[model samples]
Target chain A: MPIHDVNVMILDNDGVLRREGKQLPGVVELYAQLEKRGISNVLLSNNSRVTSDGLVRQMKQFGVKDFCKDQAMTSAEAAASWIRHNPSADRLEDMRVFAVGEEGVFRSLQELGIALANDQWDGQQWSGLPTDVVVGFNTKMDYATTMAPAWNAIHRGSRWIHTNGDVSYRNAAGAMLPANGAQLAYLSTTGKEPAAVVGKPNREMAESALRRMNVTQDQARIAVVGDNLTEDMGLADNLRSAGWNAEGWMVLTGVTTAEDCDDPSVDRVFQDIRQITRALLSR
Target chain B: MPIHDVNVMILDNDGVLRREGKQLPGVVELYAQLEKRGISNVLLSNNSRVTSDGLVRQMKQFGVKDFCKDQAMTSAEAAASWIRHNPSADRLEDMRVFAVGEEGVFRSLQELGIALANDQWDGQQWSGLPTDVVVGFNTKMDYATTMAPAWNAIHRGSRWIHTNGDVSYRNAAGAMLPANGAQLAYLSTTGKEPAAVVGKPNREMAESALRRMNVTQDQARIAVVGDNLTEDMGLADNLRSAGWNAEGWMVLTGVTTAEDCDDPSVDRVFQDIRQITRALLSR
Candidate 1:
């Protein structure tokens, strides 16, 4: 299917719109074209560090107009929704979450009325036991204080959920630094993987993004556009295999280059998000 | 072979003689019996939290007389020695080590004259690059300040070594706490296992213990006595497989009970260290 034929557009935030903290060329134009075509769009990001409000503000700074918080979906938001709506969590009126993350994770959980377990590394009153353990990107986490307790809680039967499984993220210096997946890797040494990972490549975040756009998988020919093939194209492949008419539009703006897009799973390859936008506009 | 035929006896410190900071029954008698039989002994422990000097002092307090620092071997000491004697380390006079550990790790590396990389979690003068990264049991390790740099150094091509692979250790309150192996498990998520592990089940520590005892592996019919099957008996099985006339005498003292000794690797099973001592003295 052509890019213009898609009724819903799911775009990745970091690589597609911005690269290493700067807005990429043609991002604003791409967003404007989507708005002009009346195509429902959701800006999806696996970065659990920033909330949807922060992402909207970031997109506005990039000169993208009319992009509201509702048009944005983050792993943190999806994770919060996943825990709240889960059938297993229905047993409790309020779920006690032992969280290891920054403000985005805390805010998202609070917005959903989930009680945060007050078990911190700082010597103080310890909350009795957590009902669930949620791990995100926490820069202030220490192994002795923060992680030890979380590991103990998980061993003691708390459900474990990680926001995303991206092992490394690019820092301001453009160097890849260890991310949430690295922490999860460390925690998994206790002999169990997380019960759920609410992020890209794992259908939950994609489904949430699609749902937020008021588009059903069957009702729309969706185009998942992003730079990284594993997270972006993998999600498209997964959705297609699940009977959705979805296609992955690989771009050479961030991690993957044109040479790496030879995988048959990628439906189309573009020089960047701008090229895809130009193609759709030309049509 | 009977227990009396063993010329050298290697004992595990915890569970075999002490448990949860308390001395076990017949520990002093067991040491005395080894001394009387003219068997050279070394107390091996995976605890990297304490130095060899500290372990010697602890043994003296437990009423085990004549237990000197030379008769004690820890993962810390083994790790330091492993780095020093390694063929890859021959080029560097003093290797810049990125150490994530406590007093034991520091003291062991200092004693061996290994230079520590100046890179810390706090803003300080950064060391250019580390030749090696060493991890021991650190109670105060946090992700931001300590682990981040270690992770960075490993990605930058530093050889990684861990003290042991035990996931957790019993704290003073008998609660299981994350150990060095747990930290290693976390770090390993970055897609590389440690190049070398210098603790139990690895022949480096056992070889170091044997060297300190002034006995060659060929000169002795060695008996490794411990309560844990994986660490203690596994070490004996490893040595025996490597052509050493070695036996694993499993003691139902700490982690493992009699039911766990059904494995063919375990040569003998005794109720505790006292029972093995009695059987040896009777011969």
Candidate 2:
């Protein structure tokens, strides 16, 4: 509601950081602009399939070369961190995982010592196998590949988990194809919803990201940036739902287009991430 | 994997059925014995909640009536007939007339044809208006409430549609919970995932169910019986993995318990529906 208290700014990828594999104009000046104002910014991307290092490497190819992996938070890393702190979590190393997801998920989980027991897209391939944790950040998912592990793990008292529930994603065909959430929906046919998740809109992600920025609970003033309501804007809604003044900045870029401008939950809509950053700096 | 051919037989409700509130049993007879017959059977549960209608219902209720409404399939009347003709559709009504979900998805859609709107569980709550179509079909769902029209008709374009993604049921606390799916999820979310669905499973549901039933354009005979796959045994996985000698049977007893045993699927497993019925008949 009030703009002055907002200091630490976390940016979204795709639109805010880069478009068409190219950095948006004015990004260089904006960073210089934010630094002059003593503002600390973090780039958080929901693309969990790609590592933070990859984001930094690729954005550098687009001339926003100064981006730091340390200054970034991808959904995958955030999820891993949160799971680590979970009081009674299963050991990350020992869990039999059925990863129906992209490269980022596999690499990050591996880095965290979470073994990938299966690499099939649909959960069907993993059925009858002894899988415990079923991670869904998949991009190349089909019907059979998604539901099998979910049905098996959930029935066996294993953990039913997801990286995020971002449903449809803008495909190469420009049509939004099914994302993790859609795959999860397919698994819903198994009639088992997720037992837990570590992704956007969940309090754990917000808490961990803020803590990483060294912003204490009381000292923290957070703002979630994204495009969709059920996911991006939902992040802010979830925060507010939990009594935080978290506001959502919806860019008419990806996911929810300008056609969906009337979505009531969207606190504020912007042309793109560039505009959002410009406004924050102006404030 | 190649799809396998199998024969399936389903049972009708009201006669060989018995129920209590909304739990199903007697399905075991349908599944287990049939499994021994080298025929795989999946109970087509219309219950939208869990994977299958477990055995607790029929055993306790004494028949198949205690089925969850959302999990059961369409009767000879209601939207069942509609789906028989227009199998590939996403909406049920296109005019603003009248409707709700509790009474019946069909009657509510019929009201829409004449241009009278009403408050249905999955329908809109009309206020002041002679608007388009109205749909209704929710139990204990109030009608004649003026606000109903405004929300259903006035809010969006007229052509009202009634999808039975109804998500209302008594929870463990004995308090009503929201279910059926998109509509109820929207009702609970208020401006989240819009309410736009029709019939059961829409096209996706039909195709998947048909696949599970082991019926194809090839040499295959498939019969689907059950109280409801939507609410019961909706996740019944007797026929998945693209194909492998599968057949499906949705039982009206105890959800999908042993009732599927006699189902003509490649293999059938139920709490013992056929055995119970045969037992009852012999007795």
Candidate 3:
């Protein structure tokens, strides 16, 4: 199905709206098209380095003045939200999380009033066992200092939760920098995957975005628009599997190219987000 | 087939001869039996934390008066030796090694006259690209401070070498501590195995020890004694594959129990090193 009939839009950041700090051509027009068509839009990013509010500020700088903080959902925020609504929410104050990431992860958890486990060692072991180990994208993490404590904590029975599973990200110079999943791979070598992943391809993030749009899965047609097939297209497939009428729109702007969209998950291919936006608004 | 006719003994340190800073029962007698029988012996340890000289001092403190540094081999020394004998040895003077390890690794490379690569980042990248990245046992390494440089260097085409592949090691309290291989697993997430591993199960270390014993593989009936099947028994199997008449003697004093010696690679099972030594000299 074409995205022209969809009333709700789920968009990926980084590659779709912008590439390496500069807004991609037609981003401003894409938002205008969404508004004119009365289609609710949510910006979803697997990047947990920046908070949703920070992303909104970034979007405003990129000339998307209509995008508000409420319209953005980060994996970090989704993870904290998941924890807050889970069965453990009854004793949220008592739950201790050992977090491994930068600003987005720390700030999101802090805002939710979740207690962070002490990382300092008391000569023998960690100060205390954590209730959960949350990992995000951390560029300054040290293996012996940061990872060792987390590894030992998990071995001692802490639940492992990861914000996203992006193996690599494209830097400004187009170099592939190791991402959150690469570090998670180090932790997973101890023989277990993370207990929960709240980013793209996971229904939790899509559901969180859909809830923000105030649209039920059965009430509207949804289209996920982005560049990478594994993340954006995978999310569309996951939502469709969960009974949502979702379609994937692949754009050739960052990381992926035209030849890479030969997958059944991708329902349409565009030169950029501008072309997709025009197609979605044409009907 | 029995060790009674074997003239060369390859022994694992730690578990067989000693346990937790103290010599195991009959360790001194076991060494005396080898000396009296005029059999050549080499103490091999996958531990890259201590140098061979340091191991000699440790053995001397445990009552092995005749033990010399030349009779000991650590993965650290073996790695350095491997670097010296390979085709890369021709440019030893021009080669710079980026070492991610402790005193044993640093000291061994320094003693071998190999220039150490500068790990200090000059804001953009490493001061200079390393010719080889040697990873050993390092407990104090952090991901950002230590591993980032190693990861970046490897991505830039530096040869990756590892001292050993032991995933976990038993600490003094018998608790398992993540070893060098565990850290290496983090670096390996970038999709490449190490170019060389100089420890157990690799024929290079065994060849280095055989060179020290002044014996050719065909000239001696060799018996490897250890409690771990993966390292010691695997080393015996490796040597046999390389045309040596090597036998594995599984001792029940350390990591492996008697019931675990059902593998065909384990030619004989002894209660301890003392019992194995007696069997080797019975003849």
Candidate 4:
């Protein structure tokens, strides 16, 4: 229940560690304290556009040079891991995916030996039929070429899976931009909910992260610290409801403001990752 | 309320007159009977892609050689008409619109002496900031280039308007394709409803059609005949609710079936336009 008692910490990327392309204060120290306490941590991010490798590089830029790919889990990676574990076909290699995302999504699926349908986004081109229509955060997806085909495929009975549920993401200028949830809403006009939304607040991504960390949800003392209440704190709430010893730690470093910290989802609140590091170091 | 007493008829294009690009039986004879009786008819279509010119051409193809531009009203035309009457600024020319649609939408807006913002759909190219963001049926809309910018504009204080609410449209192959409603849903993740949906079963298009036909809603004996329940019969319901002498006439030629005609929205049911023609002639 205390900061030191937390055996594993699941930290959000955009707000808790780095923000606006810069490493936030105290993330390096928080990592160091977790290492000193012999506590495991997963840099869990709902950003489906980045791979574990991309996350590790970001961690290195944040002064955590020791952060490895094993310590990082992106929604894209979680999607691949989830798909690999829950195979739609008899064989893993036989599974065809029509993925709408960047390199992270493509790489993760490829690592699991999943064949991608219509990989290229070049003008009105298509490959084999997709068994699964996987939607991630596609910043450059076109409706006629990419989405219409995906919609058609889904209508024709392909299983739909979204990477996350965040409809809008804040840009550097503090402007809201369309995210995967918005993309999901476009397809949701079909009146079918996705088979899986493998991201934050969902059990799939957390389960995958816990498995990767060699920790069981029911036994491990987990703490999910995030700036977004619905995603980060909500993830903690989900874990607790699932019978895990998890707490949702809110940080006022991103979207969540001081006024929003009083929510039931927030078990604990910190000004930023620096305050969290101070709390951990003091204990 | 008798069939012979109907002075003006509002017919849906897709289901009532034709289906999948071919003319349905009884439409020609029905037009003949209506012309002989001096009863006015307006071809009301929720499809924003086609202009009045296109509808006239389609009518000619359907063997109704006398059908003119004045007898047709598309959602695109309705949108322009709605905007012209309800201008965002003091003058219509001063109000800029970022329209997401085909040539029909462009032509309609242009004809109303309204300025268009970002007319071209070329990649990442933008002309100007929009005061109004109008969404119509665009089969070729892209996310990064078109929708994202529109989403950004809406968030930054732009009035949003959708031409129609039908999410999907049946293609020539009988497969449902993404329509403007799907595009509207995509933008709806902003948590804001459109300022106006200038299509049926909304009152804007129907009212515009009434004006075009020189018939006031309160006095004119109106019959709305279409195959779909929600858009067609629903228009009649809306009209009647607004104190109009309007009857919903259901046709069995389109999306609606024989069993669906039992709903409260249906005032009368016929096999097709031919059956309606027979009833009219007999009367």
Quote each prediction's TM-score. 0.95, 0.53, 0.90, 0.94
How well is each residue in B1-283 modelled by candidate 4, as lDDT tens digits? Answer: 8888999999998988889888888778989999999999899999999999999999888888899999999999999988988889887768989888888899999998888777532333334558898888887787766788788778767898899998777777566677888888889888888999989999889887787777975669999989889899999999888989999999898988998888999999988888888898893
- Per-candidate local distance difference test: 0.82, 0.49, 0.82, 0.85
Better of 2 and 3 by lDDT: 3
For candidate 2, write residues A100-127 as lDDT tens digits: 5677776776777765556532322333
By DockQ rank, best first, the candidates go 1, 4, 3, 2
Local lDDT at B275 for model 1: 84
**Segments of candidate 4 deviating more than 4 angstroms:** A119-129, A217-219, B119-129
Model 3 chain B lDDT-worst window of ten: B118-127
Candidate 2 deviant stretches above 4 angstroms: A1-5, A19-23, A87-93, A119-131, A143-146, A241-245, A257-268, A274-283, B1-283
Query: Best candidate, DockQ-wise?
Result: 1
Write one digit per residue (lDDT tens) for candidate 2, span B18-64.
44344344444544444444443333333322222232344335443
Candidate 1, position A149, lDDT: 78
The fraction of correct interface contacts reproduced by each prediction comes to: 0.62, 0.00, 0.31, 0.66
- Tell me the spans in candidate 3 whose CA falls farther than 4 Å from its real position: A86-94, A119-123, A126-128, A172-175, A280-283, B20-23, B88-90, B119-123, B126-128, B172-175, B277-283
- For model 1, which pairs clash? A142-B142, A186-B186, B121-B145
Give me the TM-scores for chain A across all models, comma-separated: 0.94, 0.83, 0.95, 0.95
Shift in Å, residue B8, candidate 4: 0.8
lDDT of 1 by residue, A166-235 (tens): 8777666554567888778777866767888998888888887777667875688989888888888988
Q: Which docking band does candidate 4 fall into?
A: medium
